[model samples]
Target: MAAVPLSLQVGERKFTTTKATLSKSGFFSALLAGPWEGDLLMDGSYFIDADPDIFDFVLKYLRHGILPLFYDKVKGHDYRLYLAVLEREHILGHFASPFHKISIIRKRIDEYGFILIWEARYFQVESLEKWIHDKTYLKAIKSTHRASEVDRIQDVSRSFSSELDVEYHTSWKTEKIYICPRRIFVHRGNPEACGRQCKQAQGTAEPEYEEELTVKALAIEKETTFNFEICMDDDR
Candidate 1:
């Protein structure tokens, strides 16, 4: 069969692309084939006859690397096919985590960068900070001076003030910065229990829970001290 143009609309956003080769294979067969399950017409219509929840889940997986639990054993083959497609698209990792597929999340970061990923999720700056902290991914670099030394330096700098020095030489100053250490978040609940519950909710009478994945950046710094001078002269 000839390939057709496919268009998809999620919320107010619209995406247009060529239909996959399997579009002519009928909906069930196409779904079993994977990836093609998300194909659409140029007019924002889909050929697959799936329920809204399943369709939405597939779309979410495509856009955000999130996979909802599949409940029905009869639908297992189809669901696995969908997952395979997601894996191929680099939207999910090879292994499943507590909340998501780690590989897919990593791929999204690799492809879009952290800022974009956060932006796409509509996350607040505080959420970003919390995410980093909760994930243990970023760490703040600490001052090298001892507590006493830092206190002494601050006191001395705060006390000394000279007009002549202000005009010709500026005093030295110091501050701290942070960096990411790179860590992964493990799920808190039992994997089997979560899965089973998730599946049951899907009307499949089975149990399955979607995995959750968390991230955190680690921080590192050195312990030491150094002296420096600053020149504020306007002319040589």
Candidate 2:
């Protein structure tokens, strides 16, 4: 279909963009896949009924494939709003968290630098019972931190080779930011999943192990193309 010059009454103001522009989004592309006759107002521009404040970010992400990353702009409920729009659009997985939920990654300033403090995702590192049962969990966090130290080590004097770094590191003291993780968990899912059951995960080095992955993903933000994507409409 030809691109329609779409306009939406967001809050009280009007924002205009092309259907082709919005269609770069997996969400908006699907919404605009068919004729939008009645969605148009008297002015002949398609009207979107959505939270205008939130929709600005939505449209931005749609048009540019990036959610704003500024700490001030994207603080508090901004992420949840993004998740709300994405989930309602049935495109949450398009920008999924490692756990496939609305996990919070905070930029924490410390002596080490701005390390990513994964706010919502937490795993039990130990407890009175778990301490006696699982000392290996503590050891692993220390080991992983040590292992990720090279950040990347290359033997630059020999034959030229390129490789992707799979190693990751998080602070050994997660408690500095994450607070106290629950001692025992009967469920084995992410934070949102645990919240659904009114519980949190507890056991072993798994949560700490998983934290390694989260930190790695955040650490590679500058070095990798993991930030955003130009979403195309699915053939399905």
Candidate 3:
């Protein structure tokens, strides 16, 4: 007599396969070993209360050692379902770039990639868990460096625009530009020195300076090659 094939009913769907193929999984191996003989049906088909869709992947893997691939039709929830099935079936150490494929689906799911990593650990998928941990560490370092660069730029901008405005006064005679602080400007003949002494009155916040420098800067000869525009922010 021909041998009777092993039959299984997962959820609403029924399936038939050989004992040799189904026994590839330890869970199935135990089930076939008669420990759960009380649960076997009269027709000899084992009825499993599982999602047939997710269990289909495991059946294929048992038969041919094939793993799930990222296809256009595959959705983010499918990845989670696949992982859950693998865990339920006591499958381990058999991931073929699963996390990488899941990453492609992550864009549509939003934040699902991180959750998948945690699931990887929960399901004891060691290879995928390590890969996600390493990638997350590197991404965190990059984010910190990027934030630091933005802060540095803002600090430099603030310092340049802070109190005590810097003004440029050009002297045509020496063809040099004088960096005069505040309202002070260089005299016509001496391009290196301020036209007046900047005297700070004792116990006063303001610097008392003669108006002689402003008058001299305005009186500069018009034959100058380039004129430097002066701007001051009194509020600072």
Candidate 4:
């Protein structure tokens, strides 16, 4: 007997595809490999509860094996906001370049001569000389105590606005970018044992979301070049 092509409903939008395409995802392949012993929906289509607009992007990859050209079709003010949906779908990295913008930023930083530090925090500067050595688990010192505006979850890492600048004696500066402090989940460990004691000092708070860092780099400069690394972040 010939196999049935799988029919799916993602966020009210329906689509049909062969087993070969859907199986590209280990999650789906494993699901279909077994029996349909349980009752499916009356409509006979498997429903995937996900962001409808975002799934369109995933569908592109599943059907064509390429990133969606309509990256902006999803509703959101933030440019990289769609990435969170991709991460949940579990196929975030199955592409030629998952973080296209981040790749660009990294390339430009490399073209110059600055060393890129991967996980920069807001309180990790040289000021805490004594606390640094004696403390068993000093919370990653953030470089500063001020409010930072790298709000978009993705931009939190990719925004180069306030990051440590490469000191190559080059006069040109990149566009005003926000710096992404390596965010540490302060409450992850025991509160009392924390060297900074930030958790015990403050009460529990609401949940917060994280973004995958992404950016493209380069600001034209005055006849000078510097090499650098962008210890950037990725969802994968």
Best candidate, lDDT-wise? 3
Give the alpha carbon lDDT tens digit for every residue of 1-236 in model 2.
77666676654669988867665555455556766575567887655544466566556655654333322211312234323333334434345331233454455445434343332211111121122233222222211111223322332213321222343334332221221246234433334434422333343434332332212111321111221221221221
For candidate 1, write residues 184-208 as lDDT tens digits.
Answer: 1232233332344344444533333
Worst 10 residues of 3 by lDDT: 224-233
Clash number for each model: 35, 0, 0, 23
Quote the RMSD, in angstroms, for model 4. 28.5
- Candidate 2 has a TM-score of 0.33
- Number of the top candidate by TM-score? 3
lDDT tens digits by residue: candidate 4, 48-71: 555556555555555654322212
Error of 3 at 23 (Å): 1.3
* Tens-digit per-residue lDDT, 97-179, candidate 3: 21211111112335445343212211232323332333322222111111112212223333332212323233323233333
Ordering by lDDT: 3, 2, 4, 1
- Per-candidate Cα lDDT values, in order, are 0.30, 0.39, 0.41, 0.38
Off by over 4 Å in 4: 1-4, 37-39, 69-78, 90-236
| Alpha-carbon lDDT of model 4 | 0.38
> Which sections of candidate 2 miss by over 4 Å?
1-4, 73-236
Give all candidate RMSDs, comma-separated: 32.3, 26.0, 22.0, 28.5
Q: What is the TM-score of each candidate against the true structure?
A: 0.18, 0.33, 0.36, 0.33
